[model samples]
Target: MKSVQVFAPATVANVVCGYDILGFAVDAPGDEVTMRLTSTPGIRISKITGDDGRLPLDPAKNTVSASVQHYLNALGQPSLGIDIELHKKMPIGSGLGSSSASTVAGLFAINTLLDNPLTTMDLVPFAMKGEELACGHGHADNVAPALLGGFVLIRSYEPLDIIKLPFPEDMCVAIVYPEVDVPTRDARQIIRSKVQLKDAVTQWGNVAGLVSGLFMKDYALIGRSMVDVLVEPARSILIPDFYQLRELALAQGGIGFGISGSGPSVFALTKDPETAKRITNTLQQHLQKIGIRSLSFVSSVNQQGPVVIG
Candidate 1:
């Protein structure tokens, strides 16, 4: 059996305006997994390091372990012994798509270690299993961007369909991950089941406008279109001074911002890298005043997603 490596970049989901439906990749901060095949029957994983002793090592319970299992099952090959070491480059549950990155990297790593039986296009559905296990809901918005790279819109989930959108060149995304974790399940629960008609109309219009803004490469319109009434208002309760921070960022040249992948982590998009830098600094300063210190990144869109390693 050949040993191989896989690398998956970190991702930011729900880029302010697009919730549960949009995401993009970032460079420098991602997880790396090393996979080696074993002659022993039955797939097993060892969580060697990273994650600050927070991740589960159980093969049956962890996302990376489960992803390898899916690959083995699909091949119908004899149970293979697989050992993986996940380098947790990013903090878990920081809304930077830590789990999705792990899940995607695991899938790609194992697929390569097994001699590449499945095509990349065919593997996204398998990668999503870990997401389902972690989030209790099968949402590919985050995983897709992590797996496929660039900006992604999950147009539909019935057939696990996804559409990739171009990342405008001038725009940059800055993210702030507060040192807290908000379970996706709990965050989902906080949202109001039914929204006011006015809010609903406004949201949908914004969604359409955002999509159009992407096509037109109009940063201002895209910034204007990022408004959420149903999820943000309800979920913001989990964060400290969410509304104030959001307003301050906007006033300081942040095109727009919303809860990033549930809560705690917040992100803003800007017209240029300067604006992105400003937004990043402003968010950090404001968040500190509220006693909520955060780690921030000023990054542009990533064109590459998860890829096989040598």
Candidate 2:
């Protein structure tokens, strides 16, 4: 194939208690990339849409092309002629892995056009280069799930040991993205570097419980384990009416509720699609009532990570 277009799903990272370690993909909101081989040598970002001119077009600076460049360099073809077009279908800075979707889409598209020179897992490190460029942290919480789909746990970052965890089949997610700015870089700065030993112990227990609950298909256990004592306390202040939103989600029968990644966007876990929709509607309504513009989505966990659209 001379050209390929691919779609990558948006992901919810730092799923409450499992900060920098857990994430899962959503179906609807994502990004697309179109890449084609050219006679000219070197990567070129031909165009970018849906970013409102906020994203860079330079191949060296943009996450999509930069990540693709990393993949090419790894294969010892850094001078290969290529052109990329990024289509951002999701809102950037919404705490929903916007950059990851675009980056994954770009990497997947280029790899597919090259006739699959690398496995899906092999593309992850290249994708992380994009994350590093976008947020200054080479964290895999978002990119991992966006590439592999489903729920992922980062067992180790040094060796890049990723564990795909099982989740209840009926689990659905209700996401609400308030149209506010919560840049990942700025949000990461507000996180506490050191935590009390008690909080760390509690967080560890919750992470363990959450993993166990997923494996056991225990909804109640998952709900109880979604508590975050380490990062949320410090970051919740950045979100408007964060506690009130959590209260509303729980009262509406959500299994668990918390900020999606950093702030401005929040999500609730539900057992059924109906509950997911209801929670999203309720959250959007509340945000509207409070004079905050918002976007909401309801999706079952995405099992397919990236797909060739054309």
Candidate 3:
């Protein structure tokens, strides 16, 4: 194939207690990339849509093109001729893995056009280059699930060990992206470098409980374990009415509620789609009442990470 278009699902990272460690993909709010081989010698980003001219077009600066370039360089093809068009279906910096989705889409597109030169997992490091470019840190919480789908746990970053965790098949997520800005870089800066020993112990237990709940299919355990004492306390202040939203979600039959990634976007977990929709609708209505325009989505866990669309 000379060209291929691919779609990669948006992800919810730092899933509450598992900050920088856990994440899961959602079905909607994804990004698409169209890439074609060209006679030219280097990667070129020809178009970027839905960013309102906020994203860079230069291949070296853009996450999508930079990721593709990383993949090419890794394969010993430093001068591969490729052109990419990024279609941002989701809001940038929405705490929904927007950059990761686009990066995964781009990397997948090039790999598909090259006839599957690399496995999805193999493309992760290249995708991290995009994350490093987009945000200062090369974290994998968003990119891992965006690439592998389902829930992922970063067991170790030193050796880059990623473990895909089991989740309830009927698990539904309600996402709300309020019209607020919460840059990941700024959010990260506010977090405390040192945590109290008691808080650390509690966080560890919650993370373990969450993982166990997923494996055991215990929704209640999952709900209880979704508490985050480390990062959410610092980051929640960046989002408007974060505590009120969480209370609303819980009152509306949500299994759990927490910030999606950094802030400005939050998510609630529900057992059924109806409850998920209700939560999102109610949340959006509340945000509207507060004079905050918002976007909401109800989605099951995305099992397919990336797909060739064209």
Q: Which candidate ranks first by lDDT, i.e. highest?
A: 3
lDDT of 1 by residue, 1-310 (tens): 6676678888877766577788878764678887777777765665556777888888888888887687778788637777777878877887778888888888888767656688665777877888888878778877888888888898778866788887587677777787766888888887777778987788878888888888888878888888876777788888878888788788878877877788688888877678777877887887788787788877777787887666
lDDT, candidate 3, 1-310, per-residue tens: 3888899999999889999999999999899999999999999899999899999998889998888888888889989899889999999989999999999999988898888888889988888899999999999999999999999998988899999999999999999999899999999999999999999999999999999999999999999999999999999999889999999999999999999988779999999999999999999999999999999999999998999988
Candidate 3 segments exceeding 4 Å error: none
lDDT of each: 0.78, 0.92, 0.93
lDDT of 2 by residue, 14-97 (tens): 899999999999887999999999999999998999999999998889999899898999899989999888899999999999
TM-score of each: 0.93, 0.98, 0.99
- In candidate 3, position 125 carries an lDDT of 88
What lDDT is reached at residue 217 by model 1? 86
Error of 1 at 253 (Å): 2.2
lDDT accuracy of residue 243 in candidate 3 = 95
> Candidate 1 local accuracy as lDDT?
0.78
Model 3, C-alpha of 19: deviation from truth (Å): 0.6
